[model samples]
Target: MRLMPRSLFGRLLAVATLATLAALLLASVAIGHVLERFVMRGFDDRLDAQTMVLARAVDARGRFDTTRAIDLPGFDEAGSGWIWQVRSADGQVWRNGAEALPVPASRADAPPPPPPGMASERARDRDRSHPGEGRDRTGQRQHFRTLTLMRVGGPVAITASGPRRVVEAPLREAMLPLLGSLALLGIGLAAATLVQLRIGLRPLRTLQAALGNVIAGRQHHVPTDLPVELAPLAHELNTLIDQNAEGLAHARRHVANLAHGLKTPLAGLGLELADRDPDGRLAAMLADIDRRVSHHLRRARAAMPGAPGRGAIPLAPAIGDLVDVLRRVHADRPIAVDVAVDGVTVGVDAQDLDEMLGNLLDNAWRYAATAIGIAAVVDAGKAVITIDDDGPGLDANQRAEALVPGRRLDEAGPGHGFGLPITQELAELNGGGLVLGSSPTLGGLRATLTLPL
Candidate 1:
């Protein structure tokens, strides 16, 4: 149902090819007509010359003198398709070849002969020289291109004719080369059109590459030095990017201001309740409020756009630093840490990476019995990092509940249930995700983090 192509290049090429073929066809028709006329005119001129020679043999009294005419090739031979005849008003006829020329039904019906000394003038008019059908001595019909000339003062009409092939054979021969040259010309035009399309569309490909760089955070704006036709589009795209970044920054400033205002009062309330509250019920409530405020503040910072044109950060060094700090914090407990991350990188900010990994590693260290395993690999264009502990792991339902914000499954731990939720939010903001499952190797909780490469 689709007659046209979906791509711009395909559509342009199709139109060019059709136009070239049509122009070549029209040229062939025009050239063939002109060449046919040239060949036919030359054939008729030769016949007219032979007619003049035969006319000189006729006398003024309607008599044709046989000896006065010069002998020409194919004229005097038997069965030759070339023939000349002079017919007088008294019914006396003279011919050079053995075949008799077919006579008209009436002398009055014949076309008027050319006037004396005007044979060359008459040759210019194609209506005067025409083709006729005649019979040979064997009674077979033959086609001939004939010309008739008459004496000015006598009733004698002289005619000379040759086979129609004299006009047609040369045209056929000339056509072979003409057709070949036109074919070559068409091929050349098609090749030229292809090259022109590629060169003309190169700017579009460049524009696409520039847009991709912006999306990958490798550039802040598209290049403006483009063709006149595409300059407006690139300018509009850069304007839109600036608008979005400004809006995100304004929202982040508002969130930071609100979090700071709440933290001051919450800190003052915690100190006031230290002596008045012995059960510590009000103190726990104040601590929960502080944790929520800090969670939102960190989330707002994570949601802010990253530095323009930022590059990927190496994962191994960040992991090593976090593990060393966690070991120092939990130095009283005996734990074994195995790290296998090397030569791997992730397209997330260094601070966000440290926060996400620090949360997961701290949890692993807290719940780990004696050993913890940390490894990373690239999978399907993403970096996958797994941290496993060799302690009691939660079931499927418990694992799902642990990711919920402010929902703590274990009361014995010293957390307000904000760590895993904060980690998951930061991972998602940087185009990554976190999932918790049972570790097949350590037989404990496995925290898998995936981030763009």
Candidate 2:
């Protein structure tokens, strides 16, 4: 128990365990005090009994007729601090010349001492014997008690006093076993606390394993045998995976339908135009159909942005990779790219962002004249990526039309009228947009894509 517990269960159980230890320690100390008083009082009772036994020995003669010195009971001043004194009827003392006892106070309504055979009395010690009669009280005394008895002559008082060090000696020897057992219990409690923490955290580890399986594309749903507190999170993850599968299947079906619908019509019209005005009109329509087909195909390639598997892709590294790949493709032209983006990371589907930037960089390489420059900067509230090339720029009207399907800046290629439109659609997919602007560095067409932070 320091400021912080080492583990979760340790912190929880330490509160109860430490509290119980403190309460038990307090009770033990209190009981130890009471027991010390009781043991000292038991010793005083013996002294009272001895004084009465000597008083009964006297007859009507009132004579000191003890047989031997060793016959006196409790008269040995040996262990247990035992002592005794015997007095006669006229305040005269006998047997073991002893010090005067420190007399005690009594209640006004207290009963007087009875006859010698059944006599008993108790009292607390008073200050002194009439001001100055050789008093002695030191030695850091533990417990003190006084006893009085009545006889045929005068009252005889018996008193007992000792330092607590004598009683504490035996008590400490007895408490050793109990304290050792409690120490062992404290150690056992610590071990139990660690075991409890491991058992309690098992559910979290199982949930993580289920997520790992889903990420590796092994299963669509997680098992339901989870703890009650963690069941909601498991249910939500399973439902999300199911929804993503259904949506992707539907999108694939849509792409197939579009491809089939356009392919059949273009083939039929091409055969009929073989005998009429066959001046590439059927070919142009076929090309437009192909462009439209490719546009929908790229849509299927874009990521499902709602899925949770997308990790943070560093914008700078992604841009650099795309630029390097395009550089090898356009090695014939000395196209130079200047990158100035920093450590800004954006939340994007990894494959989707790669495809978007790849297409944009390829487009710039194809149309650039002397130099193609790539610049990325945070502008206003978005990631503004400007790909500029020093080539013949598009006019205002063509710039607007080039972003749509079946439109291109230069009208000559295998898969024509589809690159810019596909790039535009991808830009808007992940909460971003594509813009047609004049390049500040190259004085040509600049494809500016703004992704919100």
Candidate 3:
């Protein structure tokens, strides 16, 4: 039902065909008009000549007769292709071979009529008044011409007619040649238009290849070798990628700087406190400083590299390492640390995986009275890691509070509790997140990290 073609090639060809057809049709009409006019003019001239000769044959006495006909070369009675009517001095009229005869009438010329008595000059003047005279009323009529001439002061008039067949017959005969030429011309135009469309779209083909190379990882930037129109687009795309790289580099630099600025001061405070005293305010302050230092240091050490992440870290080894470290740290009691991993990996930095599991393990150790557990595996297209403790689980409010940084279950309350905060921050930086829930393994609080691979 759609008139327009879907493809550019079809549309272009259709447009070309329409244009050529219209031009060919118009040329046919114009050429037909010109040839028809030319032939009709020649026929009118001949008709006018006959009318003049007959008009002159009538003297001032109004005496003329066309029955025996006037003699002239190429104007024979048998096949002259001319017809005539003569109204003589006796008012007797005679008609000839044509189906219809034209009436003779003189029109008033704006410039002025020809000299009153000159037959040569006056004939052309007389013919102009009857331009449509000999044409037939039938729809399929052939072309014809007529000329009428009147004598100065007599009742005699001569009218002549001819089957413009001499002109029209040749015109009809010319149809095939003209049509053939137009067809050839249309074919040539179509060929030229096709070449033009291909040439015009050549640059687009080059651009497509360039984009393919980039997508295939064969190139980092769009190709610079392009026509003028495409040059600006390529330049803009290259600039955008460069700017994005610059922004990532800057953010990484800032994160590193923030971590460095805080760590140096904490180390100085730790050394100073260890030198002071035991069983005093210095001891409590030392503990707080250690917790603060560990919290910030954990975050700083866990920060991933500045470069774009490429490979995923397998969750199994990463979680096992965290559980191993926790068992050592909480070795004073009969703390049991367990790990379950099913070979699933998450797309993240290695240190980021370590940091997320490390935080959950540390939190479990600090809160557990009997047992601590860790488990990680991939599920539903993502990596899920959970840590549990046997200590009394947090209520709704404490569970909510525990997820926040430095919010703890200890009577002293968790301050400088970087475990949950670092875990959540590292998860987010690696395009993942941390969730807080109740534990089934340790019957206490559970910390879960889920990351996309």
Candidate 4:
């Protein structure tokens, strides 16, 4: 379908190379034409000189002196394909040597005098294959260039002729090296253009890589160390990133304030209901309302959309803090919390990361028999943190239901089953995910969290 390339590099290279080739082609043609013209002019000069010599050597008595030392070697040699002819008023034509060429018929007894210099006088014959020159060395019919000069005193004309191929032979020989040089020049120009394109576009490539780092949460903003032409673009992108971060932060704060402000009102309403309704007829309704309010409040506190361009926070310290707090809370249970996390970073807000791990670790401590194992590492450009506990782990169905909000497996349990669901939500908000499976090493339920590296 499309003949041209789509990339900027391809299109630019193609256009530059084509332009270079066209320029070289035009220069070659112009130079070649000029060379051929110059050669033809030189041929005409020789014919003019010979005609002048012949006209001066002859006398007004219409007699050529053979004893005179005329240095016209071409005319002196028979069958040389270079000849001279003289015409007089009596319709008589005298040729110096005519072993190979015919004497052309005269149109009139006496011809008009030629111009002062040797002039281009067209002969009656138009064919290029002269009888004097049947064919040249290449077997092509040899053409001739003739010049005529007339003496002013008497009705006399002198014409000198030379082969046309002499003028063109030198031009043909000169073209080979000329065209080779131009071809080499075109190649050199193409290479230079490629280097120029790479150097010119390097700034754009750097900008693209910097943007990718920002998007992946590895850097805070585009680097300002760019060319003058691209510096404005980097500044604009940094401004936009700052604007988006401000907007998200404002929205989160508003939600948190709203949730906290509603808590007192909900509590007062519950007190008023308890004082008014003594029969507990609305007990279930009040419980549901309280649960919904608490859930909304919890979500408001935990809703962190992970900061843009934040480097991954270290995982070992966060996991250790959560494990230490949980161990103290369940000290009487004799639970051993083993933490193996080291040098791993998670791309999430520090508070949100703590909340997610705290929920998982606390839930594990509740059901663990004796031990809990926590480890984290980087895998496939993601931070994978796994927590395993030797507890009465949930089966497949229960694991699936545990992520549902407020879905508790045991109605008589010590705590509400909102931990896993809250952790899942926090993970999702921070561009991470949570998965639950049986722990192969700990012989209990395993929780795996995957987040951006």
lDDT of 4 by residue, 270-338 (tens): 788887788887766777767666655555555455523545688888877777777678878888878
**Candidate 4 Cα deviation (angstroms), residue 172:** 3.1
Residue-wise C-alpha lDDT for candidate 2, range 1-453, written one tens digit per residue:
578689755576778577757866776677667766676556545544554555455554444446532334434554333434444457665544343333323342222343544433222221111111111233233333433444345445333433345556777775677567666776676677667767888888788788877764456688778888888888988889889878867877677677767777767877777777558776776677776666555445443345344367778889888877877877787787777777666655666677678878887888888788777777765678888888787878878988879776676744577777877776776667788878877988898887655
- Measured against the true structure, the TM-scores of the candidates, in listed sequence, are 0.61, 0.47, 0.49, 0.57
What 10-residue stretch in candidate 3 is worst by lDDT? Answer: 102-111
In each prediction, how many residue pairs overlap at the backbone (N, C-alpha, C within less than 3 A)?
A: 0, 1, 0, 0
Residue 279 Cα positional deviation in candidate 3, in Å, after optimal superposition: 22
Candidate No. with top TM-score: 1
lDDT of candidate 4 vs native? 0.72
Ranking under TM-score, best-scoring first?
1, 4, 3, 2
Q: Candidate 4: deviation at residue 390, Å?
A: 31
Candidate with maximal lDDT: 1
Residue lDDT tens for model 3, 153-245: 534556665555577678888877988888898888988988988987777787777767764445768776777888898888778867865
lDDT of 1 by residue, 369-452 (tens): 999999999997889999999989999999999999999998997989988998998787676799999999999999999888
Looking at model 1, the pairs that clash are: none
Q: Deviation in angstroms for 192 in model 3? A: 2.0
Error of 2 at 152 (Å): 7.9
Worst window of 10 by summed lDDT in candidate 1: 142-151
